[model samples]
Target: MSATSVPRARRRSAAPPSVDGWELFAPGIRGEGTAARRAWRSRYVRQSAILDAAAAAIAGFAGYYLWFVVFAAYGPRPPLWAVLVFPVVWVPVMLVARAYEERFLWIGVEEYRRVLNAAVLVLALVATVSWGLRLDVARGLVVVTLPLATLLTVSGRLAHRHWLRRARQRGEHLQTTILVGSRETVAALDEQLQRTPEQGYKVIGCCLPSRERSTGADAFNGLPVLGGVTDVVDVVHRFEVDTVAVLPGPEIHGSVLRRLGWQLEDTDAELLLAPAVTDVVGPRVHIRPVAGLPLLHMERPELTGVRRWTKELVDRSAAAMGLLLLSPVLLAIAVAVCLDSRGPVFFRQERVGRCGETFTMLKFRSMVQGAPKLVEDLTRADEGNGVLFKMRHDPRVTRVGRTLRRYSLDELPQLINVLRGDMSLVGPRPPLAKEVEKYGLDMHRRFLVKPGLTGLWQVSGRSDLSWDDSVRIDVRYVENWSLTFDVMILWKTVGAVLRGSGAY
Candidate 1:
């Protein structure tokens, strides 16, 4: 008998084994059951609330001191009671905004977005109450408190998310998951989950379609094939699964899925439905209920329009401001580069931009003189993800160049590219002319937007990513480009550059 095969008599039974008392409890509540299945989620949520409250209190008091005690010493000040009540109001507002929900936590921009929205709402409420009651609320206090509260709250959430990600990476606080779908779909989802362990999914097994289950086969993609589609609940019980992710397919649909949801309710396991769509994000995907059925609606990618125009405006403005602010640093780096290497301070190369337009991309020179001429001799030593030439310790790099590359100081000149509208602050990686020549039809999607100074590629794995992974990330960015997404990438870029793991 196969390892996944159930006995013939047991397979014939429609009713499953009686649910244990521990499995009957609500989500986020601890029960007497498997040690691994304890409710870490409840503790995490409680910790988040405490952190948010603490952040709000600190922001409120700090804002009060800055506005009333220091800056506006002689000006009319709000009562101390108002400052004390600020956190009391702020925490409830965030709760109402669903900022602490598990779905929005540990991943995505939704959590931060909600926090900002809650801050805005609180500001509006404060304004309305002050006007209606003729209260002596200082405008400065309101202005400082709300923004500070939002910032501190977001920072707190980020810290929590970082801690959670670190824990997940170490194989702690992970959701033991089971993939339910055809072998092909299950394998694909498993591959993606494996790539992002911080997402907290640990796929222990899979359940293939009944007809597709091989008699002798017990494993797929290094994961044990637990059973057929019908065996999901049994497998969940036997393994004490935390999550069951069902991929879209014909084998599991209509009443079968509805019944599966009903069955899962009797246990602690949560059901997840993975749409067939790939590379699309939450903002573009919406669910519409029509005729009493939930229908997944996908919005077209925003390639152009007001949002794109706003993005372009912000990119150039930010680049110009960045150049102005970092001028001293840039000049110092230029002098150091010229002193350390007998070459021009700036390196200019032709790179493909939006709509296949060629532009002169600028970078603070990080390679020895005539480095391009040495490419042929060093081709055999290339450790890059093919198509690009990368060497961990390239002989062509100067002493100062290595440090510049490590901290990404070499890319500072790309601000000029952004100012010239040849690149964006955040977008796809700027591909070389030679690299663009090898592009496939799907890869051309990256040209839909201006190449970026820092992007998903830079923050993700940079030079360490495989060629396919690089292309996939770039194309995905193009497909799901948004202002929020860009900000998130820029934020992550700071940490990525600081760690400097994948930089060559």
Candidate 2:
């Protein structure tokens, strides 16, 4: 305080940051670490249970099937030499096929493929060893067991998958999910959560960005947006938030968000970026690291190689099978149609199929004889994606037509279109010529593959989907075409048809 002496400038200490009660912010009313531990425990417990059941099933089947093959081949254990085949050859084949892998145990199509691979590989090894050793392996036994066991194993796995799916529906085992985003983002996330309940993302709360006015204490969609960007680390530690979905927005600065992500490194929490890129799939997004920046690159649709072969095969096989199987049904429908409507059994409409090609797509006449003339009058009443004309209860529909349209039975005649190679078992649903005319350049890619009898649009809420949603699904399909994907979509189509969802 001496005037002559320079007053020592008082060095100010930084104020200590305020902290919320850890218990209040804990995830699911449990302490943060405890909640995480519980979640981890639950996951392993469920997995172990599944693994135990799978192991038992595989072991039992493998043992019995081996016995049957051995007995039938060499008649009640011919020699130690013959018996040696089971362990050396068969077991290795099973392992190579990944029959014991958890991924294929209850998986669809992959399970079937694994079973086939296991059987074929085992049999091949058996043959090779038999030939090399000059041992007569009974051809009859191999022939009978190969296809039969493969079918049985696949069937068994399918049955188990059904039970597992049902158990999940009943909420036997579910994973907890903590969403961190705005109300709209959380709500959108919740919608996806509803659809895939089996994935078991139990939304604990949507952690909101902090408020400037007061301490962060708020809820979005009944789930707490417990804290904001600044307090995220604390929120994670406090809430035991397992999955932190950083929903992209303006309020959270990119650099600050990056720092928060870095802080998450030490925690057990998984950080997920919920990019606003809706409907686009993983195969499309390529991440390019430019200096320190992560650039997201979307590749244009490429249809080539095995995809072309698979598409060709699927189109041929499915179309042929559909035509043959539906022939009788088509005949019956034809008779009914002729009787009820006094019009041609088949309605041929000039629809735009793959690559701007004009195809007379076949359909069971769902409208009156002169229905095309009525388009002008119905134009104003269009309920379709603006470009397409549709009515939930079109007045032009015949009595038989109404029934056909209800279950998408009218579209059944597209099997003929399929057989003609103008359609596929799975592709974008063909657009009408008028609809195609209105399409932007992006929409044109949908025509790259043969149009389908049933497609993403059909199974994914159909008429209920917005134009953008429909377009996106179509585009996604074009960009990510695969035989396995096509089969899955076709399988879902059966359920969708049975439910009559979104079909008018």
Q: Highest TM-score among the candidates is held by which one? A: 1
lDDT of each: 0.84, 0.67
Model 2 C-alpha lDDT per residue in residues 1-504, reported as the tens digit of each score: 111122212211223122343233332344335344445444543553454334434444454456566554445435434433443444445667776665454434565676677777767776888899998765655665455545555565666667666766776444445776666776667666666666545556566655521554344444555566677778777756666777866666678778878999988777778777655664667799989788777776557777687678768887788778778888898889999967788888888888789889888898889899998998878776554567887899999888888888889878778777888878898877777766777788897888888888898888866665677678878887777678889899999998987787
The number of clashing residue pairs in each candidate reads 0, 3
Put down candidate 1 lDDT per residue, 1-504, tens digits, no spaces: 221121211111132222232222223322334345547777889999999889988988899999877796566766776677887898889999998898888888789999988988998898899899998777887788788888899999999999999998987787778899988899778878877889988776788897877564666556667788999999888877889999988798888899999999989888999999878886899999999999999998998999999999999999999999999999999999999979899999998999999999999999988999999999899887667789998999999999999999999999999999999999999888888877878789999899999999999889887776777799899989999899989999999999997998
Candidate 1: which stretches are off by over 4 Å? 1-38, 71-83, 116-143
> What is candidate 2's local distance difference test score?
0.67
The local lDDT score (0 to 100) that residue 18 gets in candidate 1 is 26
> Which residue runs does candidate 2 get wrong by more than 4 Å?
1-72, 75-172, 180-195, 204-224, 247-268, 273-300, 372-395, 437-442
Q: What CA RMSD would you report for each candidate?
A: 7.7, 12.4
In model 2, the Cα lDDT at residue 379 comes to 81
